[model samples]
Target: MNAKDPITVLPTDTAVSQRAARELLSSIEQAQRSFGVASVVLTGGTIGIQVLRDVRAFVENGFTEADFSKVEFWFGDERFVARASDERNEKQAREALLDHVGVPEDRIHAMGAAGEFETVEEAAEAYARELTAHAAADSTLPRFDVLLLGMGPDGHIASLFPGTGLIDAQGLTTAVRDSPKPPPERVSLTRSTISSAREVWLVVTGEGKADPVAAAFAGEPADVVPAGAVAGVESTRWFLDEAAHSKAAERGA
Candidate 1:
């Protein structure tokens, strides 16, 4: 569970999604067994969307409907665009899994979109408020059983990029602008909020992510590699494909 050295699991590129899907389902079931409901934070990226599709396929093959229903989903980050936009993580998730799942509508918590709020900051604040409302009185965050994230090739987690003020932002969420990637604006859960989860899983693929993955495991500074800043309370896992873990292997991680 150490931030500097998480448990790493490497699977083939073609099989990584399926493995992540299976692990996610198993985690959800275990959480439900211990608690009446489980909260999971989802991420968005090419591999992330693939994992969602794999999860849906797994459910169709054998998973129980009740197991899916007992889990609540939240986004770790979201683009500040229209709800239906391709850039919207919630949209891709719905197309890949949520829309086909038996989970309750109210259980899927997504950040506000462009038209829903006046600014990205407003959207971030809205999501934070919603999260706080669902949290226990003594805590500022929900009991997140599992939090899945996708690391940017540059080592960013959620929307926290290197040298960005949002990387050190306080509270549950923060607004991102002029992102190194496209869309320019976004709403993301802060490092503190993401690290609060009981389990944090980084599902990464592609050789493009290899360097960052290695840097994270190498114990790079959070300001330089945001992914290194996050760790879970119980466990932190890095689920990577062979390509993604290549550099990490060289580092003896």
Candidate 2:
């Protein structure tokens, strides 16, 4: 989808909550059939956690052999210092979804959060190298079937916050030295990298985020907002609950 298209707003969080799971599984199934493998890049936050939980529930309920064995997993961005085992996104995904799901261990490719390197820049380069290794020999970009993302009140996605230098980063990943958010250090995919995905699905919620959501979706000269730039190579969609969409409707109306 084009970055200028109108945003789709749902009636309630519960509605999106119920539909997102089926949609995610459906998308993965379709992608895997179309391609030999389906690679997914995950985002971190409340909506991220919700999506993970929903996917896990779907697997536990039924469809045991859902063909996720061919699905490869990766993270869009991650904190540099925090342990991957910490109660953050990676750990949360593990506890809520990945660990419970039947995805093969080799298929899951996450960031190195153990602080193996002394600096975030080194870690970012390492992740870029890792992505290069995983990509097809002819293409440096992995044709990610799905990139699950979340939006911050300030219109940040992954670790690319507003007014941050990382917004202009060119490679697949960049280390954030002083994030606007907590835990100052992080590694995030640049806009260039995120745009390589075949599809990007942003799951956002809460009334506090409504205003920024509206700005990111309806504002002109969208370049100022990082979230406004997350257009996938082929398709992109914003899935939002009612509370998170109040300002968007008002702006569009």
Best by TM-score: 1
Q: Write the per-residue lDDT of candidate 2 for residues 30-140, one digit (tens) a residue.
A: 877788777899877877877778888888888534577788988998887657546457787888788777689988877767458878888888889889988865888
Give TM per candidate.
Answer: 0.95, 0.92
Q: What is the C-alpha lDDT profile of model 1 across 73-143, one tens digit per residue? A: 99999999998799899999989999898888999998999998989999999999999989955898889
Worst 10 residues of 1 by lDDT: 1-10
**TM-score of candidate 2 versus the correct structure, residues matched by position:** 0.92
Q: Cα deviation of 109 in candidate 2 (Å)? A: 1.0
Candidate 1: residue 36 Cα off by (Å): 1.1
lDDT of 2: 0.79
lDDT (0-100) at residue 209 of candidate 1?
Answer: 90
Off-target runs (Cα >4 Å) in candidate 2 are 1-6, 63-65, 84-87, 220-223
Task: Please name the candidate that would achieve the greatest lDDT relative to the true structure.
Answer: 1
Query: Clash pairs of candidate 1?
Result: none
